[model samples]
Target: MAEPVADQNSALPDSPPDGQGEATEPTNANREAAKYRTKLREAEAKLEATEKRVNALLRAQVESLAAKELSVASDIFDIGGASIDDLTDPEGNVMSDAVDAAVKALLAKRPGLRNGSAPWGDVGGGRRGSIPDAPPTMLEALKFTRR
Candidate 1:
């Protein structure tokens, strides 16, 4: 082994070694447990309330859509010159099948109406059956003699 360097003896520790110190405990650990539990309960209650409101909102949306559909069906009935109330049963409710049938018949009669186009109009077909014929002219009565 090599001889010790001159100043290495002075570098060695002069005092005894110190032991590891005790760990510090938090001051209010037990006191805050109840408050944290109550905060969690409040969050859960808010979640449940929000869930119930969402369900109610969905129900209202469904009802509004149903009413709008019925109004559309009523408009279809009116197009064929019949009111929905007149076609209703004794119980005062319109049948879905009748609404379906009326809309189908109208669509079949006027296929273009469904595609946002007007149906073709019929040209006048001679004179109407209700009107009487015009009397003969005075000149034709005197000049024409042959049978």
Candidate 2:
């Protein structure tokens, strides 16, 4: 009532039995092909995941490092609100001596900036000379007169 399957080894090409057209044994090459395909898929998936992890880590590290560097720079250069208030006091009665000292210190640190006169030279120091009488234009007011 049932048909018997031929043994894999006994199914030779030259001696195929009746009802069997040809020997069709599963070969090592087919099995190896399937195994390699599975391995390739697994490797591609792992590579994608590793790339995602590395990108995320690098992004986080860059942001954290930038924030840290900004914090350090702020600590180093932040002059604070009080210093600005002191510098902006309008009256000539303000503490100009301290401001002058700070400017001199900065000029000393950066010697290249000392080529010109101080910004407050005209305010505190007496006028260098008298303006010429009957100054014709605004440009004439800026000219230095010999004492």
Candidate 3:
């Protein structure tokens, strides 16, 4: 019988350079890196969602506090014949003047109310000082009904 040939697949001292084991290190590293990237993205998404929820809660709380303060202020000023709506004019109606004066007085006495201008104003001229044109009379408003 012919001598058995050496198993060509076995590692041998004289193996050709091109016949070395497969270069799996690069591929393995790439797979591991991709997995890490995916996990990082997921973590970032979760953090963003949490931040959004926190922001929403904060906004809701602030709104609630502001509404309560507005209601209390309305009750206090109603005694002086000043309503909230009347104090929102450009030229500063009587009620607006009263409210401004009251705010200033409170700021002087308490020192904390001086954080900024009172939330009362048609400031910036966007919708504050501009007057709404008068609505048409009943007859004019109903002109379309006749046809």
Q: Using TM-score as the measure, which candidate wins?
A: 3
Tens digit of lDDT per residue, candidate 1, span 23-74?
2223355458778998999999999999788655543443333233333433
Worst 10 residues of 3 by lDDT: 62-71
- Name the weakest run of 10 consecutive residues (lDDT summed) in model 1: 18-27
lDDT per prediction? 0.55, 0.48, 0.54
CA error at residue 12 for candidate 2, angstroms: 10
How does model 3 fare in lDDT? 0.54
TM-score of model 3 vs. true structure: 0.36
Q: Tell me how far the alpha carbon of residue 60 in candidate 3 is from the true structure, in angstroms, after superposition.
A: 0.8
| Predicted structure with the largest lDDT when compared to the true one | 1
User: How big is the positional error of residue 117 in model 2, measured in Å on the Cα after superposition?
Assistant: 36
Model 3 misplaced stretches (Cα beyond 4 Å): 1-22, 71-147
lDDT of 3 by residue, 1-147 (tens): 899888976655554566445565687789999999999999999999997886555434433333332433433343334334444445422343445555455445555423343476544555456475896788986997889
RMSD from true fold, candidate 1: 19.8
Clashing residue pairs in all predictions, respectively, total: 0, 0, 1
